[model samples]
Target: MSVLFFDIGATLADVSVAADGSLTFHPRPRVVEVLDSFAQVRKGIISNPGPGATARENAAAALEAAFGGRFSDEALVHWGAKDRRGIFDGAVTSAGPGAGDCVFVGEDPDERVFAREAGMRTAAHPVFTLAAVEGRPVFWARIEAPDDRSPAELEAVAKLDEVVPVHVASDRLVLAMATARGVRAVEQSGFTADLRGQVGETSAFLVRDDRPVAVPVAFAQASAAFRATAEATMRAAAAFAFVSAELSGSRPPVSSLGPGPGGVYIAAAAGVPVEDVHIPGARPGHIERLLPDPALLSRPGQARAERFVTAFAPGAPSQETVDAVRAAVTPPALRAHVARISGAGPLVDGDPLTVRSRDASSADNERVVDALAGRLHELGLEVRRHEFTWRGHRLSNVEAELAAEASDAVVLVTAHLDSTGAEGEFFDSAGRSRPYDPAVDPAPGADDDGSGTAAVMATAECLSSMVASGRTPARSVRFVLFNAEEQGLVGSKAYARAAAAAGDAIAGVLQMDMIAGFQGGTRTMEIHAGSVVPGPVAGASDALADLVAQAGPAVAPDFTVQQLTGAADPAVGRSDHASFHERGWAAVAVSENFFDDTGPATGTRQYHRPGDTLLDRDHDTDYAASIARTVAVAALTLAGL
Candidate 1:
């Protein structure tokens, strides 16, 4: 089989840093489907190692977490820099494929060029390589513009069949016109004086098109003739009973066009007879007095938002489920959980519990992990710790599993437990910063990830209570608190990799990160799904988002849920869901606004900063509770409750 060498970063996955200075490499959307589609073909990774030994080790762990055993050891190239030709040569040799039999799929133009120079075909995207390997027809064409028309017009014609535009001189149009008219004697030399002025050093291009043709003479002529043809076509389609209006000379008020019945209002203002005022494209039976619906023309985002809210109205599900979810996910409960996690409660003496450093050896990080695991165990969950070494630091993930009555199918709910401050910079009350020794400083990190961690813990408590009350679900549920996520998703990647290796049937992963802060106004929450991830996985992601959307009205009727597809912010994929997405599992992230903004009420900004404290003014636990409730409803729905 022909071997395919793939690039990792950006092309396959996106790398993000957590609050604790950990990095998480999230796979691009639909990568799982893309990889599975080529399962019959051999695949390998050709990635540049990270800068330092620690970074390199983290990259290796991330790769294993994302791809698992899908790629063999010999097929993987994660050590050396990828810019060198030696790397390409080595990758080909390791894959046991001849130079000609191998194809390199990468996102970098320079790397692709280097691969091509090494005698292997290269594609900028995996889809293109798949197309070529499947023997699909790849169209290509070249055509010149005709006289009396611009290159852009001719280019439009070329674009019809996905062809590239080649702009030749205007005289080429005459040649094409003559050729179309079957004038065999016509040549560039025979062009008239008018056509000669248009001729110059024009560019020729090679384009992609479906049709088989040496030169697209007919296509060029059609493009050049389009304007006249279009006018004629429109005139022919028009009913002659309605005369074309001439309102320009009447000096109609331009301001009348702002809104309302602009044409009729203009005619009336200009004292032109309504019957004589002809609007272009108006048919015989068209209503002259009709006004455009402002809602139709204006942005319908609000209306669409209402539809989502209605879908999640309480009436859609049983009162029993809704009550259970509500009782478990209350504002007071969430607030207390946040207080404990942030060390603002009496239990920890009000000192900031800095979970910022992702280094496993950090006392604070391990202490937080122990505390969370103890809480899960107290809630009666079968707790397990997933341990792995990343960047020479040993990391641990705390997972609590609630097995269902008879199913092995699993629903994974997760959050990153690590927090981060201003790195080394210390900020004052006014947000002014100064360098400080991290060892002596504190990063409260109450909102960045503490909110997520608390929500997951709260969810576990709620579910455990339901289970104890004899309300078991049809599928098993796992509540996982990931470590080193603030660094590079080190902990979750390890868990996902092991799950895939064990052939675990994970139904989906709902990642809660930064869900507590309320941006005020309409209390909006953002649901993110990677659009590039396709097939059942992408569908599942969308479905999960939709569930969250529908849960808004039922759980938090006062709030609005906005679903964002592949959020432009890189932070959207910087969580544990990305690891599951990399493995082709369905995952979605539930969070507060994915943008940087001053707190709507308090104007205090605490995302990933030292001021991420558990303050009621900024970090609204009520808002977080609503989000938790919505998540609970969605989880129960997915668990087949």
Candidate 2:
């Protein structure tokens, strides 16, 4: 069992300050419902006290008023700052659960980082905390087919409420013989020999024009048996019809019935024409076997193992290099870069920088692209724009390559620089689909791609400085900012296709999307690699993932890296790296684990919303910088610097 720790402010209770300087504390919406939902789990609070004695007293008082009766005082840790891991350690000890089995839910990203460092899992919301405790996957899927039954028949099926006796018939002759003998003879017949005592009774033989059978057996058993005899021709001849019918107190069957023999059992049981069984989070397609599996390539040779050891052995990046990269990717520097690209700074007063829709004709979008290109030029690299047409829309991708002294292989680092608004309906916190006014609600996209863009810029600056100081790599490094990614990876797809057509010797591709927003849970970064990609490419992707995992501790030392292979969600292929995967290029996407909705790591709630701005409340530049550090080290390692 897991122990759950919650932060007070904005997490459990809402704090309000009136104009009159009075502070009011109230429970957050559905606080009681949320708490009641997790009644079985052990709970505690780990909140930092507000500044000063009076403020701390007020905070403690507020918590006491809200949750005093439910939680013990021993479970609350309201004194030290959250950044200190000791506070969480104490909470874990107080909760009497191992650090690995304890989870912390807090609104602040820094708090989450500290919690993770303390060996606890974190979540941004209480709902997500519940999901984490319950171990729910991020995505769900269902198979469905068109309903063609008459309204009357559908209504009659819907009115089913109780278990009804069913008669199984092998053929019309069997039915006729049973009908002639009446219900008594039918119950005594050997037809139900295997089903004796299992089924309550046999009351009637279903005719050709009768209501569908409602099996008296438990749904679990009936579903299992349906799958068992699905493909048996003899079993298929066993027709069933309801003998008794009621309208109330019937329980619906569980959703998943699992694959079995395949036939009419499900259709009869579900009270609908069987079309297809729905499987949540499952990819719909025919499974194709790949011979000489890609896993062979991931095996380490003696030489490769030695090389890995030498690369990360000790002080590989050196203290000076670490400081330089850290200084270059500072939050202040990244903030300035974000402001430059977004065009929303002190001068603009928070309006969106540009409407980067799919259309290439939008001058504002073009201007943002041009601004990024200009910044790349300032980094002492010659910028090139790859222009191509995708689905009738003209798109352009910006590239700036840092050539090596003697190698032709290229290491491509990419990030999309486009933003998406609420163009279509999106689900809200309550899982309700709602439409937003895009004109009034422009997607700031600061954390979505802006964080990635800024990280790339910061990386370019660091690499340029290193190159200027005579640290020339053996392999070329290509920095690319893709456009129209929000429009289904149009730009990157065209670029990858062009590269493949040109037969460029590319070593690997690292694509970044939504790196900044860290709404305090597990400080996890996910590396997404497509297993279905060509063998060499897939192997390279695995190698890169290993390198990244190693680089985190060596370079960033604070963030944890998680590798996800063949991620089930379709959205995994929604980014720019997918273009390279399609062309059989070695590529892996680096993103916050939160982007994967199938797990508790499902990232920031501010994604693609107007709230995805540079505000400290939502965005964490330090977290983004940590990711940049890891990427830089991984890139330099791949470049053989």
Q: Write the per-residue lDDT of candidate 1 for residues 186-217, one digit (tens) a residue.
A: 22323221111110101111111111113334
Clashes of each: 23, 16
- Candidate 2 residue-wise lDDT, 101-207, digit = tens: 78887644457667777778765455455544654321111111123422223212212211111111111111111111122233332222111111101111111
Report the number of backbone clashes for model 2: 16
Taking all chains together, each candidate's TM-score versus the true structure is 0.50, 0.49
Which segments of candidate 2 are over 4 A away from where they belong?
1-320, 346-362, 390-393, 423-441, 567-572
What do the candidate models score in CA lDDT, each in turn?
0.55, 0.54
Reference-based TM-score, model 2:
0.49
Poorest lDDT segment (10 consecutive residues) of candidate 1: 198-207
Q: Which candidate comes out best when scored by lDDT? A: 1
